[model samples]
Target: MSDTTTTVDRAKRGRSGSVILTDRRCGKRVANRTKIYDRRCPGLYVSIIPAGVATLSFKFTDPGTGKQRSTTLGIFNPETFTVEHARSRVYALKALDPAALVNQLR
Candidate 1:
């Protein structure tokens, strides 16, 4: 997704890298105008939405087309979810058989 934040700053600070995100780091990045990808999680990202509500999302290569795509996993709810929980979801998604995932959806 695009944002009003300049590319220069993002590039200098890095739009993506190796730093692990803590709860506070997640909060800070969530406020940024661009989606903040977690270096530790290949397909996981925090979408740049309104402050106080960070949306956890995942990106994957579409098997059929071999193209990258993204989808929302859920929003961060401290009482119900946290960074570790979200990362676990990403791992779960990665571990699931694609066909099984589709069947579950049905």
Candidate 2:
């Protein structure tokens, strides 16, 4: 019998599969089971409230220093004006990186 090896290209694959986003408050990765929603809105929206209204932020992990830091991306109105709606809006914002999406809208 001849030995044969198969090669797999990881980058070509759709996603990292096991990759995760951690929640700063809970100190746990945000699970895929979380809910998301889409809503119609008018005018410009911003996510300036860091603690409230589900502001967009980025978490940076430093390997050498073993430290993690978070930076605010921007402020968005979300337009729902409700807690439940805000949560869903935040989830979509996080996943889609609204900065790019918002720019494309204009």
Candidate 3:
């Protein structure tokens, strides 16, 4: 088919979608989801999925291996777990040693 499929816009917060009459060149992968970045917290973002559920993730560099890694902090809850809390969690994880961080991964 000439038309690829549906397109979704994940820019900014809240929900956004539209019927984009896009004519893209063939043979390229299309992204269906997007991440909501936290301005105050680096590496912390809300991962949006096609199932309409968003989760919190913390990306960091492994101190022991020096390799980049990511871990799920928790579910993204505006009331209980805010961006500030996510930032604090990032700080806490940074303060911990690699071994401890592995054990403390949630």
lDDT of each: 0.70, 0.36, 0.60
- Using all chains and alpha carbons, the TM-scores for the candidates as numbered come to 0.69, 0.24, 0.56
**Highest lDDT scorer:** 1
| 1-106 per-residue lDDT for model 3 (tens digits) | 5967876555643523322111121112325554555655666666667555566688777667889888887765556765556678888987888788867874
Candidate 2 lDDT by residue in tens digits, 20-81? 22233222233332211122221112222223443433343433456654444443333524
Candidate 3 Cα outliers beyond 4 Å, as residue runs: 1-31
| Models sorted by TM-score, best on top | 1, 3, 2
Candidate 2, residue 69: CA error in Å? 1.0
Q: Which stretches in model 2 have alpha-carbon errors above 4 Å?
A: 1-52, 78-106
RMSD (Cα, Å) of model 3: 11.9
TM-score of 1: 0.69
TM-score of 2: 0.24
lDDT of 1 by residue, 4-57 (tens): 764556476746554575567656544455567788888888765556567887
Q: How far is 102's C-alpha from truth in model 3 (Å)?
A: 3.8
Candidate numbers, best lDDT first, in rank order: 1, 3, 2
Query: Which residue pairs in model 3 clash with each other?
Result: none
**Against the true structure, what is every candidate's RMSD?**
7.9, 13.4, 11.9
Pairwise lDDT winner, candidates 1 and 2:
1
Q: What's the CA error at residue 31 for candidate 1, in Å?
A: 6.0
